[model samples]
Target: MTVKPGSIHALLGGNGSGKSTLIRILAGVERADAGQIDIGGAQFAAHSFNAGLAQKNEVHVVHQHSSTFPHLSVAENLSLGRGYEASIGGRILWPTVRERARRVLARFGIGASPDQLLSSLRPAMQTMVAIARALQDQEGSATGLLILDEPTATLSSAEVARLADALRRYAAAGQTIIVVTHRLDEVLDLADHVTVLRDGKVAGDLPREEVTHETLVQLIAGNSLPVSENRGQRRLAGRVLLQASGLCVGPLANMDITLGAGEVVGIAGLVGSGRTSLLRALFGLSRVSAGTMLFDGAAYGPADPADAVRHGIAYVPEDRLAEGTFPGLSVVRNVSMANLDRYWKIARLRTKAENRDAAAVADLVGLRPRRTDLAINQLSGGNQQKVVIGRWLLRKPRLLLLDEPTQGVDVGARADIHRLVRGAVSEGASAVVVSSDFSELAELCDRVVVLNRGRVIADVTADELTSDNLQQLAHMRIAA
Candidate 1:
């Protein structure tokens, strides 16, 4: 789809759908083997990818993860390129640079204490810095073709609204904008034009008025996804293997829950509704301000990930690549990473016996029977995710925590993961699965706890789960 001047356009798709690839091609990060791109009526024949970057079209692309030098202060990162422009004499006046950095960061709702290191802030705050740095031009106008790839991923609704307003204002001031997102609701409201990419190709290009949420859904998934069955009762509340009493993290608060052995519990919430924080805290990634988590009738407080893993609480984070598996690492290593204690002693030396153990678990997860040296990166995206889950499967935890377990995985592999989840249950292990796709929760979980702004809105059974119910719990106000 051609982006007109001063238009707020959107590229929408699921993971590996070429949305990132297309954006990278446009940003000159990667080259397109075929097709020519026309920018603002300029037909740039693609000889080399860098040719587009050198054109100086005032283009800036912010990817999903915030790219900030963690050791550097937020103010310092924002003012990195600005220093060349803000310099007075041959030398950069440090005090003047600090003064200008605060002004630039303030525009993005960020306070500039120019010396604060990036590591001191949260991931979302770091993302705002990347956005601020992208807009560090004079009159805040460097984003002639500002491309925000999942900018609202880690943001709250209010923050996303602020960014949507900012995009509108940018478009108002004659700046072209493109937002690459998976959320269809945001596109209907914030985007002026929408282009759907399926299988590394453009499937549909339509104006905002011409596209409905249903239309976009059908286009993206090819057809409507099947509705999950409203099956069996909450018959098996056998024993509370994992207990959360007054679990309060950032947005989650004052919650009481129990997961029985041989059962699955699902957590449903909007992207910003504190679902991620709830799981992270359970896994000991985030701080748990108030509440106690009891594992097998014992108080559990994980000092770190090692503590969590050692205690048999394996968590698969939302960003699978970041939290789940090492891509470049071999499949053998991916599986063995979790169960290293079984092999390693006082030394970090890996054993061949442990390698055989890893291969056995991989085969169990339907990851083909192969040599122990197969690189996980060389496998398909779905298989890579399987390797992640397979690795955790080797843990054989009593309680499993899965957040968006199949986000980027394909349809078939999704079923495979569900089977593996059931396999865990058969082994007398319970699980608490966090997923935005409510149907998935219905299919794989025995019960679901719907959260809104960190509070448990409703605790529902699998029989009561549906898209409408999930939407009501996630979006509309639940009756107090």
Candidate 2:
């Protein structure tokens, strides 16, 4: 429970491990029942758990999703807490606020204009603004603590590196920082002290010197994880299930892909490299202006997702929360949404039969809580992803398209998902997986296809799939 001053501390845990709850208490978003918090020797009682009280104690939190107002300018967002320079009647001075914003932005190395709209900036810049706003008050510099929750979850690798560099600089300047992240690599790269939480209690605490990947995984899982040495087992190429020639979708040009039955193919690319676009094109979510596709010896161009689904094709979108799930729906309904026809009998919906089948698939997918009646939003991010992927299992899809399948998933659930996908592929279903994690692609795919500027650069077999190789090929510059 002791956090050293002027140090970077990382909090690691599995889903539902109370890491977020502990952070909320610190951030003044939640109240503690009994215990007191000692920040720089200043004791905060349970009753003093509000935003103003937390701010007075010099505690600030930057959430995973930025809370910056899209319509407001950067200067306005940065000056929200500490209002603008005002006259006797509280008349604000716009010039003073803009000047303050410029200084803050410059201090954080964020190359953005104070007058620029928050929505116009990229994700990384918006995160920078969030941090800059948190660090606005100079009066409590020595006593301040910055709490970041999963800051790099949606950032690209380069953006993460930049954020890490900024944090290191802040720590060097005697600022205390607490970061909650599931990415082990980020913890190792940016933290000086590490604490692992399990089931609402501290499982292990260690100095950065003593924490390793295997040790952390063991602490999080409460046991040693199985290390599979037999990786990338090559599958016998089956009959050609999908063939795309000269495909053209948004940001995708002349992309050619050949997928065989029972084979798993991985698509590797950087952000905006048309990875998601290609998957959407195949799933009929995006319009393919020019392309010829052959599916099962027939010309296959689906008019929409319904047509694609009817043709035995399933798509699990990249943004699971936004696109792949309905939060208001029950777990059973979400699980059976892709195949409602199977539950129809005599023009009446079979509710009991649907729940029964959904519960079975939920069990197979290792969904936590194992409750069919609860709303999908009640589950954790990992379990929600499981529901989205599990829904397709009942369809017995001929072609499965997955994008960033394990983005927010935990370590154990990630393994279960990989097993489920591979099991389906083994049962003669073709799969196309798009992932930014090259290691995931190497482990799950029989072949890896690298894309750069919407063009295929390399087609690598399972044996040749390595993180370094995939990274290099996906980032390699192609001549126009």
Model 2 ranges with Cα > 4 A deviation = 1-66, 69-228, 344-348, 475-480
The lDDT for every candidate, in the order shown, is: 0.75, 0.83
* Candidate 2 per-residue lDDT over residues 167-253, each given as its tens digit: 888888888999987667678788999999987989999999998876776676564223246454678778999999999987678
**Candidate 1 on 1-480: residue-level lDDT in tens?**
788888989998644568877777787778778677666555665546553452366668888766768998766787665553345557767677777777877665674477789888656566667877886773645345788888886666666776777677668877788888765667888988999887787889998779887777666656433556533234476777888899888777787778887788889876666787877887778888898899888998788878887778888877766767777777778788887777787786567867888778778878753555787777777787777777788778877888888887888888888888888887877888888676677677788888866688788864466545564455544332
Model 2 has a clash total of 0
Tell me the TM-score of each prediction against the true structure: 0.74, 0.61
lDDT for predicted candidate 1 compared with the true structure:
0.75
- The ten-residue window of minimal lDDT in model 1 covers 224-233
